[model samples]
Each structure stands twice: as C-alpha cells, then as structure tokens.
Target: MEVAIAAAAVVAMGTGNRVLYKLALVPLREYPFFLAQFATFGYVVVYFSILYLRYQAGIVTDEMLSLPQKPFLVVGLLEAFAAAAGMAAGAVLSGASIPILSQTYLVWQLLLSAIFLKRRYRINEIAGCFLVTVGVIITVASGSGTSASFKSTGILWPLLMIISFFLQAADTVLKEIIFLDASKKLKCGSVDLFVVNSYGSAYQALFMCLLLPFLSKLWGVPFRVLPTYIKDGAACFLNMGSISGCEGAPLLPLLFVLVNMGFNISLLHLLKISSAVISSLASTFSVPLSIYAFTLPLPYIGVASSLPPGFVAGAAVLTAGLLLYSLPQARHFGNTFSQQK
Candidate 1:
C-alpha cells in the first residue's frame, strides 16, 4: 500500500512538474534558459548530497563508482538537449501539448532499442507503438481544450518536441547498455542507482553550463544577468502580487527543480519495488491529470482550461496501447524488470 501511494505520488509530481514549470514560465519567461539550468544543477546537488551520505555510511562500492563514466556523458548530452527542448515547448505551448507530444517517446524507444540495442520486440509491442502514435496525433490535431495561442507556436515546436523525446529514448537505450555491461564486468555485478543519477546529472550540468552563452543569447538575456533574472522570477512565481486573486503568475522555476528531482527519485523508487510497466503506467496517468489540473481555475491562472473533444478517449487509447505493448515482457520477465538498477 505504501509503495502504491509512493507510485501515485510519483505520477502526480511528474505531471505537476510539467504543469508547474510551464506556469513558472509566465513570469520568468525572460529567464527560461537560466531557470532550466538551475533545475539541472539543483538535481545534481541533491543527488550527490545523498550519494555523499551513502558513501560515508560505507555502503557504496568502488565498482559502482568506476562503472565507465563515458556512457553517462553520452546520455547526459542527450538529456540536456531533451530538457532544453521540453522547456522551450512548455514556455511556448500549452501544458497539454507537452505530455501529448512526449508520450511518443515510447514508440521511439522501441524503435531505437530494436536498431541499436539489438532488441526484437513482439508484434503486440509494435502494434502498441502504432496506437500510441495515432493517439498523440489525434489529441494534438484536435486541440480541444488546450490554449488559445497554439496557432502562434504552430505545429513545428510540437513536432520538434517529439524528436526531443526520441533523443531521450536513445539515451535510455544507451544507458541500459552501459548498465548491462557494467553488471557483467564488476564483481558486485550491479551499479548503485544514486551513483548513476549523480553522474548523469553532473554530466548534464556540465553541458548545460557550457551552453549557457548560446541559451542566453537565444532567450534575449545576457549571461551575466542570470542571478537577477532568477531572483525576480522566483518572487513572481511565489505570487508577490495578484491582479484578480487568480494565480496571476505562479510556479517557482527554481523550486520546480526540487519537485522535478523528487519525481525522478520517486520513479526510481517505484522501479526498484515494481516493474517498469507500472512506472510507465503511473506516468501515463499523469497526462490526463495534468490536463485536468490545467483546466482548473487555479490561483495564478486567469481562466480555467476546457477539455478537448477527444482528449480523455485519446489519452486512454495511448495508455492502453502502452500497456498492451508491455504485456508480453511483463508476463515473462516482469521480475527482472522490477529489479532493474
């Protein structure tokens, strides 16, 4: 029961991270780049802090630390790109679009796994991927209750968002390969989750810092003004002032870093105790919940959003497809997946 609750929390936080981060952009729109950077750096610090504690307790192994950091670097770069693209989409597009487009990652993951990881998926998995693709397109194309300005952003960003998720899929496949190799090589035969998280975040932070100048230029802000931008954005995110008691502009971007990191930790915990299918299903539920959250008349929001025509049905199809895709593996290898680390 506790584990179930934790998994549910993970889904809530996961969806909230996107909805809240997009909300956070209302005020800090000027500092989107820096705010994203802060989230990445904050996660690194938190993960490494816990990692340090574990090390002090003499619970970590040398093999875990030495498990070839290069693959992490590769995945980190992909992560950086995906993060940037997602943040950009959140800023310009509706909260609903982010989840709808992001769900396509599962399809990309399977394709990548087949090509690069040499994994062959069953017919049901392929069919599931096709259904997910159809569902996302249907939801986005219908654009039922999302936003008024999606026309301005056009369909380009959303399509690019799908590609960004494909990058994420590639990263996932690569990381799995790295882990499998490490397990075979190391005497202990398994890597620590914290160690993996810490290294991945560190590499991403390093790359994000490296790209700061470019990002600042794109955001139309100077690199030197990041501190001030973040400061003001934080104040606005906390609702320093309100126009009509609605959340004129809520969502602390820096604070979002905490919640986002929390979501990841919860996901990992769920994965530790259950199968990836469960984790994925929990994540799938976040889509409609996020859409629902966006439609609510929240404090910072000016107006409640409306549900799109087929939003619920489309989401259901996508989620069902994902489940069906995983059914084969779950029936045969559910135990190994739950213990995957």
Candidate 2:
C-alpha cells in the first residue's frame, strides 16, 4: 500500500512536471538552455537543503552520507549527457513526436535492468510494459502523426532522443544498484533517498558548469553572451526587470521547479522502495495524464486543445497495463496479509 501510494504520487507529480514545464517554457522560450540549466543547478541547492533537514531530524545519518560518492559521480555524468542529448533533440523534434519517441524509455529501462541488475520480468510484466508503451504511442499520435516531422527532420534527432533515454535508463539502474549496495554498507539500514539525490545533483551541477560553454553553443547562444542570456532569463523568470513577455513571471517557473523537484523526489523514493522498472513505469504512466491535462483551460496556452480521438481507448489500455503489472504483487501481499491474520 505504501509503494502504491508513492507510485501514485509519482504519477501525479510527473504529470505536473510535464505540464508546468510546458507552461514555464512559454516565457523562457528564447532561453531554453537557461531553463534547463536553472533546473539542474536548482536541484543541487534544493536537494542539499532537504538533506540537511533530514539529517537534523536523524532520518539521515553520517554513514549513509559517507557510503560512497563514486556511484553518484557516474550518475551525474550520465544525467548531464542525457539532458544534453534530450535538449538538443527536443529543439528540432515536434512535440507530438517526442512523446511517442519517449516510450523507448521503458524499453531502455527493461534492457538495462536486465543487464545491470540481473533481474528478470515475468511474462505478464513484459506484456504490461508493452501495453503501456503502445497506449502512450496511440494516445499521443492520435490527433497528430509524427511522419511529417520525421520526413523534414530526418532520423538523427530522433536517434539522439533514444540515446538520451538509454542514458537515463542507465542512470536509474545505477541508482538502484547504489541502493542495493548501500544495504550492505549500512548493515541492514538503507541509504536515504536524499543522500543519492543531493550528491548526484551536486555532481550533475558540476558537470553542467563544465559543459556550459558547449551547451550554450549547441543552443546557438555564444559562450561570451551566455552570461547575459542567463541574466536575462533570471530576470524574466523572476519578473524583476522590464522584460517583455514576462507575463507569467516567477509563478509559472517557480511552480515548475517545485513540482519538478517533487516529481524527482517521488521518483527516487519509489525507486528506493521498488525497482527501477517500477519507477520507470510510474513515470511513464504520467504521459497520458499530462496529455489530458493540456486539454483543460490552462493559462498561457491561448486555447485548450481537444482530446485525441484515441484518448479514451489509449487510457483504458494504459490503466489495464498498470493493473496487470501489479496483479502478482497484489496477490503476494494479499497472501501475506491473510497469513498474518
């Protein structure tokens, strides 16, 4: 029940993360790289602050914090590259196509977990994943097809997106590995989620700093003017200066950052309590929900978009997939409860 609730929170927050990101990007459209950097660097401060609070409360201990930083370094590098690739690909790929392509994340998670964690899935698990992926592809591609976009942009950007997801899959699997290894180091106590989040985020911010010049160039912002661009972005984000197109200001971006933080924390917590594949599934489940959210009367977006023709069907299939995947666990828990009774 605890894991179920956590997974549900992950789905909700993940949906918010997607919606709020789109909202936040409305004002910072010209400074996409800045927004990306902001989130990456912001996580460092936020995660560390929470880590301190948890430590003070005695939920996090010295041993957990001191377990090992090497794994986090790898996680940081993987996340840095993944973000780079994702941003680059997202620049050219049509929004509709991106969601369809993102279903590859599940495939990557499955393969990486199998290889790294030596975990095998039951037949129903694989089928459930397949249904979830298919449902997302159907839901997202219903009203708009990706063929036209692919024809214009070719395959390189799409391939980069796939690679980006692959890197992300590796990062999640490695974090799971860290948690698994931490059990031994902590002698029956697991490392706190913030320990992983803080160190991983700190290292990612370090790598982001190192790659800033390259990233700015990739985003077509010259290195010398990058600081000015970021300064302007901050102004626009805060609505501090007389910046045009700062209608939403701090609220939208701040909401995005907060919800994005919640989504990440929830995701990591789910990963701690469950497997990487389960965490990924929770994240994946948000795709359709986010699609539905965008159809509502949201601010910044001038008009609410209509639902996709296949939305209901796709959602039903996705729900079934989730239930199918949980069937065995539900049964196991039920049996355990009965025995206790």
Candidate 3:
C-alpha cells in the first residue's frame, strides 16, 4: 500500500513539476542559464542539507552507499549536458514538439537496458513503448498546428532534443546499474534513494559551476563579467531585483526548483521501490496528464491550452498501452533476463 501511494505521488509530482516549470518559464523568458544553474545549485544545497540533518538523526549513513562516488559524478555530468542541450533545443522546437520528441528516450532506454543492464522486456512492454511513440505523435501532429515541420531545418531541433533525451535515458540506465550493483555488494544491500539524490545533485552542482565559463560564453557574457550576471539572477530570484516588472521573475523559478526537486525525489523513490522499466512507465504516464493540466484555467496559465482533436484518442491509446504493459503476467518476462545472470 505504501509503495502504491509512493508511486502515485511520483506520477502527480512529476506532472506538477513540468506544468509548474512551464509557468516558471513565462517569467524566465530571458534567463535560461540562470534557471538551469539555480536548479542545479539549489538541489545541491537542499539535498545535502537534508542529508546532513538525516545523518545526524541516524536516519541515513554514507556507508550505506559503499559504491565509489565517481559513477554518480559521471551521471551528474551527463545529466547536466543533457539538460543544457535539451534547453538549447527547446529554443528552436515548438512547445508541443519537444515533449513528443523527447519520448524517444523510451526506445533508447529499452535498448540500453537490454545491452548494458542485461534486462529483457515482454512483448507487451515493447508494444507499450511503441504505443507511447504513436500516442505522442498523434497528439503533437493532430494539433491545430504542428510544432515540428519536416521541411528545411525545422526538424533539426526536435531531433537534437531526442538525442539529448537519449543521453538522459542512458543516464537513468546507468543509475539503475549503480543501484543494482550496490544492492548486490553493500551491507544494507540497497542504497537509500535520498543518498543518490544528494550525491548526484551535489556532483551535478559542482560540474555546473565548472561549466559556468562555457555557459556564460554561450550567453555572450565574458568570464569576468559572468559574476554580475549571476548576482543579478540570484537577486531577482530572491525578489530583490530593481526591475519592478521582473521582480516576480525569480519567484517562479524558485517555486519551480522546489517542485522539481520534489519530483526528483519521488522519481528516485519510485525507481528504488521498483525497476527502471516501471519508473520509466510512471514518468511516461505524466506527459498526457501534464498536457491536460495545461488546458485547465489554472493560475499562471495565461492562455489555457486547447486540447487537440486527437488528444482524447491518443490518451486512451496511451492508457491502454500502459495497462497492457503493467499486466501481472509481465513478471514472467523479467525472469528470462534474470536467468541469464
């Protein structure tokens, strides 16, 4: 029952993270790098703070994660690149096209899991992945106007986003390996999810700091002048900016960071309690839901998004695919891969 509740929370939080971030992006229209860095550094500070308190209270110990820290560092670095690239791609791709194309990670995850994690999936699971692609496609393409175009350079950004998400999927698969290995060799047998959250985030924050020069350069700010940009962003983020109009700009990202971190914790919890396949599925469920969320006359949703004609049909098909994939008989398929070990 607890696991079920946690999984449900994961789905809700995951969806909320996205919708809320969209709202945040409204105010953050010109501060993409700031938005990214704030989340990175914010997670580091927030996660490690919780870790410290938990450690003192005897709720967690570093020893539980007997694995070397390097893997998590590598994961963080890859994650940073994936995020930066995805954000860059988003600048070109249509809002509707980005999420749809990003679902390509499902396919990449399956392939990576098969090759590296030695994991196998049932026929239905594979079909479910395909259905996800189809569902997202219908929703995106059947809309009033397609976000991605097939002609000229219109398709390039979506493709880049897909590749970035492929890297993101690869990162998730690698984290799964880390968990599995720790479960096999560590004294507790399974590392705590928060531990990974803390360390992975910390490493990512570190890497982001290291990459600041490059990020600043990309933003056309020189290395020495970058400090002023950071200061200005941090100030506005805290609602201390002189620009009265953008005073609220920082607040949205701050809220976004909090929600996004919660979503991360929920996802890690789901991943820890279940398998990567289930974790992925849980996240996949969030796409349509998040889209539906945007359609409501919610605060900050300046203009409610209209549901495309194919939305219901696509959602129904997606739900069916998820149901088929989650059928209990899928258990047998898992054993085939486990037997290879």
Please give the CA lDDT of all the candidate structures: 0.69, 0.89, 0.76
> Model 1, residue 277: what's the lDDT?
36
Residue pairs with clashing backbones, model 1: 144-308, 145-308, 246-299, 247-299, 247-300, 248-300
Model 1 regions more than 4 Å off: 1-10, 26-30, 85-100, 144-160, 234-255, 268-282, 326-341
Using lDDT, rank the candidates from best to worst: 2, 3, 1
Residue 291 in model 3: lDDT: 81
lDDT of the structure predicted as candidate 3:
0.76
- Model 2: residue 335 alpha-carbon error in angstroms: 17
With a 3 Å backbone cut-off (N, CA, C), the pairs that clash in candidate 3 are: none
* Candidate 1, residue 66: how far the Cα is off, in Å: 1.7
| lDDT per residue as tens, model 1, 236-332 | 5555743232243453554566778888878766654553434555666676667768888865557887876777777777777767765644343
Global local distance difference test of model 1: 0.69
Q: Of models 2 and 3, which has the larger TM-score? A: 2
Model 3, span 93-168: residue lDDT tens: 6666666776788888899999998888888789987887788777656873653253433766677788799888
